[model samples]
Target: MLMLRLVIASMASSSLSFQEKYDVFLSFRGEDTRNTFASYLYAALSAKQILTFMDHELERGDEISPTLRRAIEESKISAIIFSENYASSTWCLDELVQILECKKTREHIVIPIFYGIDPSVVRKQKGSYGVSFAELEERFRDRMEKVHQWRAALTEASNLCGLDSKDFRPENKLVQKILEDISFKLPKYLSFNEQLKGHLIGIEKHIKEIESRLSISTKDVRIIGIWGMGGTGKTTLASVVFQRLSYFQFEGYYFLWNVREEYSRYGANHLRKKLLSELLNDESILRMDTPFVASPFINDKLRRKKVLIVLDDVDSSTQLEALVEGYYHFALGSRIIVTTRNAQVLKKVADDIYKLDGLNEIESLKLLNLYAFGKSSPPKNYAMLSNNVISYADGNPLALKVLGSFLHSKSTDEWESALNKLKRIPNKDILDVLRISYEGLDKGEQNLFLDIACLINQSFTRDDAEKMLDAGDSFTKIGLTVLIEKSLIECRKDNKLWMHDLLRQVGHTIVCDEHREPGKRSRLWDVKDVCHVLERNMGTAAVEGISFNMSEISKDIKMCHASFSEMYNLRFLKIYCDNIDNKKFKLYLPQG
Candidate 1:
């Protein structure tokens, strides 16, 4: 079985070497260590799906073969196992010389494994090593320079930092150490190309903040949460951080995406099995049509290994219980990064939380220009128009991306028309994501959010909002907190109610969705909509609240009580103007 595996690997390696580089190159004497430590090393590397070149055929030559030398050069790392009689083989010596030459010239990584033989013996040509060199000198007496080169390569290769078999009692322990050292130094950066597809503007600082919270330098297992509103780049930041840092110290890694959707669709049992199968690298589990049954074997296997896991788009407590809470005890130095819009969900599980924000002005502009103008900055003629779109985005990456894509090749007149239309109708893609947090709320919370949204009050205090909406202070405060935690709204330093422009647009879209007609809508905040309802006395019983900045209308416009007669359920009415000239417009109210 072992020989067959090696033959297959050698064939695969030979074919791969034509176009691909090996993750590691293993060099060892076949008779002394091939079936022992060398076999175990190759098995370990192969299990990790790390491509390795191993000479399955017996060594019979005094010089390294062309294919063997090319394999050494193509490999990113070389693991040389110096066992008893390792220096006896000329082929091993030739392989070592080639490995070291590549190391010196290509700056490749070379790992020297002292397999039961002290590194000092290999370094200084002591004991059996000296006898091996003496024999080599006798056999190659005419070519003494070749023997000198072998001695120099051994001394130099043995000086590298690597696993010493003496320290690791059980031979498997040494193999484990070797596998980890090679994995960490593999430099798997290119895989991020598929993970991060779009403009990565403004993500560096976020990645740094998340890494700080992860505490990767420590050995403690930590659950770090990337908490923020939907479409704020939490998932994108997590993906980048996972790709770059996950390979640094982790032994196994699995990135489980759409945890909420998957859990909801497949149930806890299936997700657990999927997690185990992927983390354990067991393909048979997936091949089974039924979900793999849970057992202590799953937990026991995970408990011993250090891994990096990412659970993206986690929304429910059930998902936390099944995926995270079930396997929270990963080995020390293990880290799990979870991305969610709900702070409460993360608060229950995460050891440290990084509150992610959307793009800032400069980043928003750059990202917009990338999608809109296909450059880092907008064309000079479109600078002002570009700023206008950025202002509408207000640092929200989703909105910037959607709006930029929408305005990609449109004319200036189209840009103005689209911006105007956006004020009345939010982008569907951006609105759908923003609505997720809002939809998770209960009926009361939704009503409260809609009321706040219709208020369009950038500075509504908690007390002022409750008094105006008549929702009671206690109810309003709790609803506001929930919105804040979900990141649908924010209570800034001024302690006033605030929300993202896109979120506010979401609220507008929702009310608009309740009814197509302006008068029949549950809330009326748009100046044109309210004016349409008032000027025509089209107010219907569906109207619950109306806010109008009369200063936006003609000074001579007049509103009478009969206009709102049908709006008997209208509980809140706000009509105010910014200037004294606004008071000239007349407003007549019904007598008590």
Candidate 2:
């Protein structure tokens, strides 16, 4: 099979090097079917942006022109519309022979549409086919070999997969089937670029997990969901799997990226139209104004087709329903893969849910090293700094890539400074991407997220964090669970509340955005900012929470009672004085 594919690819590259100019070559008897079925098929293919060569001009003689022969070789597939009186034309027979030869040598696809006829009749030259062949034989009795060759070519073409107009109820239905068949056979539908071949590290394991869940060898319709945080490479892993499975002989395939964003931008109906147009290979569906109207159309057209579809970055059940609602809408062997940040969205629909985690420590380091140094290992003297960056990234691929690229060509001192600055301030590029998931949270969930990101991350247990929030017990518990389901936070086995560093940074940035000055902000963590606020009595009513690292400040630190008076809304406060003696640190609070 491998060798056969190689040979086919070589022949296609060599013979149809100009296939970009046309997708299909049409051959037919003009008087028999040109204005009828042939014209409809050509228009249908063209509506799908399929460039087809259909010769409409009157032929001067029986001999095939050089231009016609070139068109036959340049096309990726040939659609021969064999109708009554088709065999009477010697020119049509000659074109059929050339199409068959090209199919044999170049491995080009050949689809025979028996218009108002039967395959056995066309193959055996019986009935009207036989009558037309008898006339041609009598007229060309001197060129007996030519007549025999035409007969053999028709027999070969009739044996392949094709549509019979009689099998379909109406002519338009047959035209649709022909379009579907040709679109499925065309190679452009499965072409994925190879730019990420080497960059997809640690994706094979995820792909294997998905494949096992898919069980492609079985004839079951499987819907698998891959849920993970943003920048965890969910889309990357899905794309890799899509490309690998494209080699399978499925009836159709589509990889739709950024489903949530697309639906939000163009509305659900537009997305539905786009999905249907790509799957059915007909762009006319885009005219539909609402998903309610397109849903039934999709179910009717794609019900029996075995297709593979990947819906990436989906955020809601509405989006899923708008595209692919139920398993019954597709064939038995079809497979659908969906990637999302919200696990709750897949709970009711996915047959099996795979929660994608960040890369492991080793994989994270290797990825950072590759991006920073263009290799899999760090430079000789930069190992410590590299390890620091890896520790800060905490296995998040986006953070590692951003930090690595930022520190790529810097000196040791610069690396140290950047690492230190990152400890206090996260990279904006990384923060912006990670913030998307946070921004999707509701107001209550956003408050809980900020609480964890700014103050409770890693330092407090889940129960302790919930107590600090001061909301009702049930409300706080459900909010935290929602955060976990959203991939924004996780509860460790040791009962600690954990969140990705980049996500923590995002939360901190959100709080910081409320006020440029730390004293005016709702949350304050920096020691210098805290001391400045205390020493200058700059505290404000806007401050909802404040924390001071006393160990990082002077032992002679003192605060005025008036500073605490100004913080009228402060509900949460922490003072870390590990290095200083208790008596040396003085705090003055007003007596209410």
Candidate 3:
């Protein structure tokens, strides 16, 4: 078997002399699957220019060898081909030990490929394979837990789609599929093409250093925190960074969204279940009473393994504390990236802080054009309006998106009207524009949009939206499609939906108008203490349906309600303020 592997390894001689690094290291017991499976796998992988390293010579001694250990360390990814008799071999066990050690030192990625045996048997130390590991641990009883940990790693990986040796030969379609899956899992950015599409613009020197830290080998948990104001594009910056990380290049990678919102309801258990189900790509077996199932699924599987995890939109230190305990549970070379609106959040979890600055004028214009025209440049006729709109937007991407989306198909009259409304409104907050856009929508669209938007007030699911909206495809698919294209809402990679705070504020503003019951809106407000009235009576007022006058509030206070509907509501609500929010205010109120 060793000879066969050596013969195949030598076939890649064309690139061998230049000493280019090997892409994959194939490990297996020479006796069991090497001759039958590893040999074919080696040839096929090598054909694709994926380097394979396998020892050909039979050593004189039975002792573990240093040559094999070094080979395992230098390789970027180790593919351990586990067969029935794999654990019985001292040579294979030694290789396994070294592979695991290198994994701990952040030296390489390890993938345990179950060729013929069941993964759970290895993980639980069951059957013949389990017995072999047990014997090895007895010899090295002091390091018994380490031995078991390697077994657990194999089992955890096996939970992800397993390849059967009998069913999948190296050249078989299944083998190719598995190889491609592994290729995707390998460290490459989320979008290699996009990264190369054009050079990154306006990225600071420190940002590069943060990315460099991610690239370098390290044992400690590396945390990068990106902090900025509400409209400063913290999410976008973190997204670009996540794309660059090529987390799939590693053995385990996960991107978690809205950490602050989810933690509040589901607590750590829900998050653990999410990580296990989403990251592992496993079918959820979550039960409230048996949350421990999710913990063991992750802890037993990913303990001490290098993983790239992204926790986005973290608002509080408690959120971070709940999700990630410390670096100790993660394998060496693990990297975590966090994004938040709070600097204190960055200070808490981040080893280094990157304060995300607003986009430069050119970048801002480009972003606006992307939203307004779906192209990189402004149209000839719309350039003046576009420039005017951009100036009013003041370089906030969220504002640009909302404003551009509202003006996307409007005529010159509409553009002037919208722009005038935006200017007169004073608040000009992006969410305010979104609110106005919501107000401008026809009743059906407005209702559906507000339903989805308000559902995000506490961060609900699409199913929740489905139940709340109750209007079939119009509300669920078509309405969501329209909202997303309009840039009013964003669907996270995780199944949950997200409404920009601006958009949520807009939803609040739009709901506080002609659509809602006047009495309910009035009950929440007190026009006498008008400033506090507007501030405290915002979201609930929107829900109860009252549009308040924007001009009545001071400039700063108006800015707080800078959503489009709020400004539009001002046109009507300003005239009615004297009569609203009074204890004597009375109107029909919806009841359960």
TM-score of each: 0.71, 0.66, 0.42
lDDT of 3: 0.60
For model 1, which pairs clash? none
Residue-level lDDT of model 3, residues 1-592, one tens digit each, is: 9999888788755323323156677888888866777887787777645667877674725556777766776677788887888777766766777777766754466777777677776666579877787687887688777576667655555554545555665447656655765565443422322322222334434356567756646666778777654566566556566654533344567788878668877788778767655545565535446744435546655664667778887766777766666445666677888876655555656787766655667866776676677667887888888888767765566676667676777787788888787643434555543354464356776666665543333355666565545533555666665565344565667656766545554554554554344333422233333444444433332322223333343334431333222322221121233424444333222232
Best-first order by TM-score: 1, 2, 3
C-alpha local distance difference test of each model = 0.81, 0.80, 0.60
Kindly list the per-residue Cα lDDT of model 1 for residues 189-259, writing each as its tens digit.
23322213344678877777887888888988899888888888888888878866665367789899988
Cα deviation of 184 in candidate 2 (Å)? 19
Clashes within 3 Å, all models in order: 0, 0, 23
Ordering by lDDT: 1, 2, 3
Query: Where in model 3 is the C-alpha error above 4 Å?
Result: 1-210, 213-215, 277-288, 291-301, 424-429, 432-592
Report the poorest 10 consecutive residues by lDDT, candidate 2.
189-198
Q: Which candidate is the best by TM-score?
A: 1
What is the C-alpha RMSD, rounded to one decimal, of candidate 3?
Answer: 21.2
lDDT of 2 at 463: 84
Per-residue lDDT of 438 in model 1: 86
lDDT of 1: 0.81
Candidate 2 has an lDDT of 0.80
